[model samples]
Target: MSPLLWAVGSLLLLSLVYVAPKGATYILIDDNLDTELAPPFVLLQEGKALDYRSTTVVERLMNGLPRNALRPGLQPLVGLMALLDPLPAYLLHELLVRLAGLVGMYLLLRRYGLPGARHATLCAALALAWAVLPTYTAYGASVLGQPWVVLALLNLRLGPGRWSDWLVLVGFALWSSLVLTGVFVLAAAGMVLVWDASRHRRVAWRPVLGVGLLALGYLLVEYPLVYSLLIERQFVSHRVEFDYAQLAPGGVGAGLIGAVRYFGLGQYHAGLFLRAAPLLAAGLALAYVPAGPARRRLVQWLAFSLSILGVVALFCGFYPQLIGVAQRLLPLLRAFNLSRIHFLTPLLWFGVLVLSLRRLPAGWLPLGLVGLQLLIGLSMNPEWTLNVRRLLGRLPATEPTYAAYVAPELFARVQQAIRARTGQRPAQYRVACLGFPPAVASLNGFYTLDAYQNNYPLSYKRQFRPLMAAELAKSPALQTYFDAWGNRCYLFSAELGKNFRVAAFPAQVVHEWAFDAQAFRRLGGRYVLSAARLQHPERSGLQLLESRTAPGAYWRIWVYQVRN
Candidate 1:
């Protein structure tokens, strides 16, 4: 098949793969379901997407989560949620991100790595594999648009670039997060410029200007972050108290092991799959291939990419220790995760795959490698894997369909029942969740005192911490997780541990519920929505309000009202 045909075919297949599940079955947990969906939905629903006031807040989560804490509403992907329902909007988002990746990888390969029609099929195949990588859709174009950024940089560096190259950088800044992706991308670009300057013995002003433009774009797009961080410091961020030592993987020995693992497999958050095996095999194979210009170019590219990964992996492994020293001088170093440089590695690994495969004798060998990568990438996707498992009649009971996850009917019933019993609207009283994410309730229009927010007021964290203080005291790990890193300021149970997706069938009961009723009430927390049944209800000053279950509901929500 031709390159264009292959590209079109892969996109159509992806549409089927993602959209076929629709509401019945798809991933609605972790970052996508629990955290990301609610923010955009709330912003658009309340007509607060464009609200740029410093006081602008979404009352759905973290007890008045700042608008800046959520993704910017102006971005095209976020705006899609305003036009369409969550499912369609999200599917479109997935398609758009993958499409960006496909085009970006193909363009990068054609322009820099593999030029000419002879290499088109190989380029398409490699690009197809990259697009299929199971990255978090919530990240939008951050992971996927990386190749485009690199292409733009190379264009500016090599020659007088087209206006299209500038457009690529601007579009990237608009779609991607400054903290999650922008910082690292700019830093990587700067490092490359330094490397280039050393080789050429002079600074290339054009690419430097390109990098400056990209940075300026990020500043404009993510102005809220700039406002919060620099312009007007509203409240202390919970990240200020981030204890790197406790969060890091044990001592120096474990850190070294982590570095080695990172060098091989890459980080899980960055489209991680069967990266190490194929890349390693290809590199080893390339070493023994007959020496030529093609072989030399492949070797040089592989060495350079691998070296970057090695340095990044080592830095990440001992990040905690490095931060410890740095924080003593500049305390904010604790909040900044320098390890996000690993986000760039997945694209580099794919580049390695392309370079190595391009050097091989064309046919089944290259095709097989691409095929292997595609299968692995698809298998790693939660939505795809779940659907595959369901099709094969082997899906686990614990796994929930997207409909079951966002059960509007179930939540509506719960909402109506609460109103009938208490004569109070959802906005009148705050809710806290146990053995489940507070985001579930928040998305259902409940005012939750607890949430899984990336950024929020440090005062809120302190206020919420007291309610679960006793529970934290039970487990040292939980104590560190809450006290040090308190992003998930939910009502934690010692018995439930970290299992947020509680199944109703097994009826997981918490024997000892250590909760402070006064503290909860002080935070205006009138309702406690729990998945687990408490052994002694009165012990926590919670009276069971209602316990409801339905056919397709993920949780058998037991509503408990605090005794006044």
Candidate 2:
């Protein structure tokens, strides 16, 4: 079969089955839109631009704006794609990721496979399996950053003619997700260089040079915007702490597996996949096969590096989350912004397919592997881990609705009143919430704020404001007061609620709603809801309106609307 033919087949398979999971982003990334605007705290401070000194999301978001000092040179490209298509850039990112994965497989095979059309066909077949590997496509397609990171890895060694191409791929890599992925690219290049030198008795400066130039191009394009954000946006002050030396396992897998058993995901992917799994065993059999050509050996090295990533990903799986807790503070590693750690499979196996292509038995190996995957798919968990949720769901739990919102809403409502009383639009507004979503809602534009380090809750809890917000605002030679009180509004979710870390208010409002979780369980487990505005229509906008808008029974919202 022709390589082109295989490429077509891979594309067809990807289109049919390997797409983003509809609800996968629900836990953190999807529900949260503030990440697109900037950090919540920065928006609170009403800084439309970012400061150069900081490397946080707030900084990147603000810097991406035209007026920001630390400009995102490539963020506009993402934003542009979003604008042209009338789709969320998040969704658009999924599109890019799928394509990048396909292309990456092609390049992987091109570089390592035997000289013939078989290389392309094998790459296609391998890509088909990988793209459909529930873990890789569904998990990864939902993410914007990981796919770009995969592509950047592939283009890091493109031929000499396209400086422009290098700039785009590298730029997208640095621009998307956490900027630390750029560092990942650099490390990959170094590892690639070392492998080449040792394996062939000669260092391949070209690959190394390509990667370096790409990195430089990334920084060159990104600096102006991000640097500005560093100066302009307070949220830019936040930093992710990563510690490579302190690697440990976490029970990410268990937490999820527990969820699965509790929620039925246990019966979905893993359980089903494991039941008739010989095909999986056979496909995997190829991964462990013996040696191939020198180039194939290079593929092996890349695969090894990816395996190390897989091991690192176990941080999200085995240590029961304490390890992941500590991971948030770690430097470069934190920026990988991994939600589904399993997404690494495609990137890793792309190399495996490339290296193992030569040794693949021609006759029935491909069909056999596909059969193994299909047979195994039955036992694996198709849904996600839901044990804790299911266990808790089985329990009847309730807390009083009174003041749950006001306890936090008082300060917030007062701030809203104050903003209304003053009739000033503070230029930009930010509201500190569990995440930045509501803060972005306070006004029309975006804000700079912090997330509670992805899904892992802040160890600080009530003090999370001081812990989460203040740190997000702190830059060199800064005061604690400056960091803590720097925001305009704070939103507290009464359903899953907290007062956060700060206490200040001139305006606030609290509204509550009640929904029977039991009703949903009884009615096919569906929770129905609607919202009403407590405050009059005249009170909408600024901070005052949040108190006006109240949710159904299952939730309550407490808002602190600050003066501009």
Candidate 3:
């Protein structure tokens, strides 16, 4: 088959794979709440961009950064979504981005000198199949920067010999740096440049210098912005201290083993069938290939892959003891997800495998493997598709037929209750959820004090910690309870709720105290929505205004007026 036909075929297949399982409703993992749902909602409602630093309540309370610290790469897409309905726009956007990434991957493979046209086509098809596997689907949809990161990596491999290439690189670099994953792409590009220089025995000064200056300029401007919003505000409440005991079983070796297993194979049940044997075989065969661009590229990728995996394992495994020494020496490493390092691993593994198989005939071998992977992905789709269906309430999961997870009927009832009781707009009142997931409230377009996000301002935590302490002090059982739970438990209490805007205490603390109605009123909470019976609801002075079950009688939403 011609390369064009191959490209079109792969695009169609992957598009179907992506769209089939997705609904015109939110997917509830990772940044679905913060990045996917809230930002676009805020942009449409307020006619401005919202990101980690901007949409956050503490940032708003402090009037901290005048602008969002996040890059505006996703703004254009978000703007377009605002013009249409969010659910349809999100599904369409996901389809297009995945398609674009696939095309870019094919082009990158072709440029990497993967021998014949047929070989390149087959390799690209395999890579595309691998890319859309269930393991990555959730992230691909929720994370805005992913497709751009793929395109940026492609440009990195293709190099910046041309003026246009340089321009594209700079543009993508600037745009991508808004997402933390983009930073890793830039780092990978730097490694590529270093490898090129080492291979050629001379510096590629122009691109090297160009990347350096651009990065330095970005950091100069963005560092203060991030530091102010994140570091200075103590939003790094999620910073994890490395613990050696958690690594157990085998210490560093066990950590490395777990990282390799989870990162490479993924956590999904389908991933049990998606073994690493073929990819590992390809990697091992890299040693036998003759010295050339393909071999050199494979070597560079392998080294890059191992380096990322090793760094994460070493830091997480040895933790506070050994890793703390490194953290003191290099402070920036303090705030990072060791597991996220795996985000790039599958792609790199695909590169190594595809390049290694370039010499084989473009026939059944690649096609069979691709088909098997696709089948595995399809098998997993039913559960996800069912979930989307359940969430969207039997509505067609298509464009122009979007529905929020909170049924329109239920939402209207809740709104009516609040309006009747408060004589104010829903957005005017700071709302909290007692037993329901916070996202449900946020999805219904309420200005909920409850949220689920990564970072929270330290000020909010400090303000709230006293209430928690008071509660714990009142209940010796609670103090004993947390003492059993440990330090990581306390971190969530300090950070997660305040950052996410959830009004209730952290799970570890919630069971210990009766709901403090006076504390809720003091914190400016005017409404409390509960899915379960509230503890000491009378003491909290919460008046139940309305109660009704959601669609399918799954759970009841109880709206209460917080009597000041």
Q: Which candidate leads the pack in lDDT?
A: 1
Deviation from native of the Cα of residue 424 in model 3, angstroms: 1.7
How should the candidates be ordered by TM-score, best one leading?
Answer: 1, 3, 2
What is the per-residue lDDT of model 3 for residues 116-157, given as tens digits with 9 covering 90 to 100?
555665656654664455543323322223333444444544
User: Clashing residue pairs in candidate 1, if any?
Assistant: none
Off by over 4 Å in 3: 1-26, 29-35, 50-77, 134-160, 174-179, 209-257, 266-277, 280-333, 359-361, 376-404, 466-513, 539-541, 550-554
Error of 1 at 24 (Å): 0.9
Residues 195-277, model 2: lDDT tens digits: 86798897655566666666666665556444444445333323233322233222445655543332222122111123123
**How much does candidate 3 score in TM-score?**
0.72
Candidate 1's residue-wise lDDT over 474-540, tens digit each? 9888888888788888889878888888878888899889899888998888889898998887899
Ranking by lDDT: 1, 3, 2
At residue 91, candidate 1 shows an lDDT of: 76
Which residue pairs in candidate 3 collide?
242-319, 449-501, 450-501, 450-502, 451-500, 451-502, 517-540
